[model samples]
Target: MPPTEAADTIVALSSGRPPAGIGVIRCSGPQAFAAAQALAGSLPEPRLASLRHIRRPGSDMLLDEALVIAFPGPRTATGEDLVEFHCHGGRATVDAVLAALVEQPGCRIAQPGEFTRRALVNGRIDLTEAEGLADLLAAETEVQRRSAMARAGGAFRRRLDEWRERLLALSAQAEVAIDYADEEDGETAPDLRPAIAHLRQEIALLLTAPRVEPLRDGVRVVVAGPTNAGKSSLINRIVGYDKAIVTPIAGTTRDVIEIPVSIGGIPFLLVDTAGLRATGDEVEAIGIRRAKEQIEQADILVWLGSPCEKPAGAIQVASKSDLAQPAERGGLRLSSVSGEGVQELIAEVRQRAAALMPKGDELTLDRRQFRLLGDAEAALTRAASLSDALLVAEELRTARVAIDAISGRAGVEDLLDSLFGKFCLGK
Candidate 1:
């Protein structure tokens, strides 16, 4: 989609294609009601679904029986007059409805994310809330859904508003002090140093909190070990599928095979890598190099080995335990064949992953918001050190601008395009 204002009525399959019981076609713009009336014979009352016989305009040929709902301007999702057609879940039926709407004078197909973009532009939601909505749509696990729900529910935005309000108040206080420093017997400015320090401390705490990005992108757990150590078998058991090929032959698995698995409601990327060992084959050598690289990037490394060969500093797992007793006393011992201690291993991994998750209340800011917050924190930190009210006020203004950027109060036109571009069509 191009970067532009929504000048025409837009239509899209808000509910995805057929095989289900129903499909919804959404239209929003100044002419939304006119377009719906053109096809449905007459517009339904606002916010109420009315059964209608949808037909082609002029020819008056019946398209399908549908439930049509109309919403007048400023109260709808996009803050524009909107219409929805709930029709039979069939490709031909949906296409015919869309075709009829587009044939009208002012209606056309909506671009990807155009609907939500309209919502943002119309003051229905902010950028942070929009991001949360995107996350909610993409969430696949319980934890992801909970986090995204918190964000979309405006919890995170309310917190940011509090912080922004504080900074704005402080900035205003500093400006007032500067304005009256020369006045005779003027009221003395409140000491802002303590307030600046408190704000800095709060921002620092938020910055230091555990990040939730791993929840959005699953936590990576890499299996590293020498050849034929049951790494593939162990991962297969954990994921409950043969995601990786298990063979007794050395160097059988070459390349990184990643499977997503959820343990204890935490999502994880279970990576089965090529065994780490010196290999004569060129392809096997490349795979071994990639395995080492995976180890470096992994959040948790499960070093699968025999009783005597565990590596240092990894979560040691004694593989093929049915064939040999555990060499180490504290490490998790498991036999993939017998399924012994596999659950224990999973529990351990979950504990570690949970440790890495951010607090439930902390918002997962995107890269732009993170950078902006960091800048605000830095500005506040600088303001805390200065005794001069003018310099401190300048720094406070900088911090205020940074905070405002997060909520789209200033300088974010290009960012809006980038953010809305990520959204799929019909949302």
Candidate 2:
């Protein structure tokens, strides 16, 4: 019996790709129980796993013996009835079980991020937490993982909750101030200045915190310098691999090659560009142009040329120090041939990278969250500056709306599809 479309039961293989030792097949929604029962015969005790013979419906052939568990909801992951079939981790075995469940009324395959999205829709989690979960899944470094975990664990949600409460109280106080403006000689007017100031200060602090994008996208470290200054050699040494082709020829590297590597737990994109010079060759000239663009946008620049001519804050490296030392011993002294000063150079890079990174699992805002916080802070600033009760209350309301958006309490319909699309189908 197929269940109605309005009450569809969703099923998916929740674990890693099959052909492993075990695969977890999950089902949720109104038809979860019926779908699981159709395959496993009967449900296990709530939250308890029990062995059951999963078989094809209306057929005598047995499929696989699996451990089955059920979670009745408003208390489960999705806040709905959910069930899990721990089947043998074989592609065919898992597929057979999924087919059996889909045959049940109202059961169908889950879409990408459908499970987590349902959790969000059902009030199990807020937007910050959902974003955190997505971050955790896509994390490529330890810092990224820890930061994502903090977000997924509701750190931002709790912080937003606090901000929202303060904003609401301030809003109510502004309203009261307006209502009782004539009654008392400003005695009844709750002074919102202190609270508003404090809240604004906090928001400002968060705005200054390290952002999540740099951690995810990696620090852009561009290696640039004059012809034959060992630019490629320095980058290859830094990354400890021959990512950039090393040759004595000045124009050997005729393009920008970016190698993403993690150094001392920090993500860095080591970029090797064509040696800078007046080149007449069209291809090399184009590469030089692209290199200049990369240099302009680089977070860190390893310059292997004259220190006086390097970009602002660029780390000048006196490359090929194995030979007689260059007169200009500026920036970090490095010799790729003798492997000297490489560790110190890397340490310097890490020191610079640390300033741009979030410290040890601490929460850092994404671009969207940062922008919203800025709006809330701006509104609160206006509220604090205004003496007119009517204007003050209006500003407070604006602040409230901005704060509400931090955790997705207000309009965020456009963000839902983009955010959920980042997740894998099982998530």
Output the number of the TM-score-best candidate: 2
What is the Cα root-mean-square deviation between model 1 and the actual structure? 5.6
lDDT of 1 by residue, 139-191 (tens): 87676788787778886667678988898899899988887675737678789
TM-score of each: 0.72, 0.76
Worst lDDT 10-window in candidate 1: 324-333
For each candidate, the alpha-carbon lDDT, in order, equals 0.84, 0.86
Collision count for each candidate, in order: 0, 3
Would you give me the overall lDDT of model 2?
0.86
In candidate 2, which residue pairs clash?
Answer: 2-105, 3-105, 3-106
Give the runs in model 1 whose Cα sits over 4 Å from its true position: 181-187, 201-205, 208-210, 221-265, 270-349, 358-371, 408-419
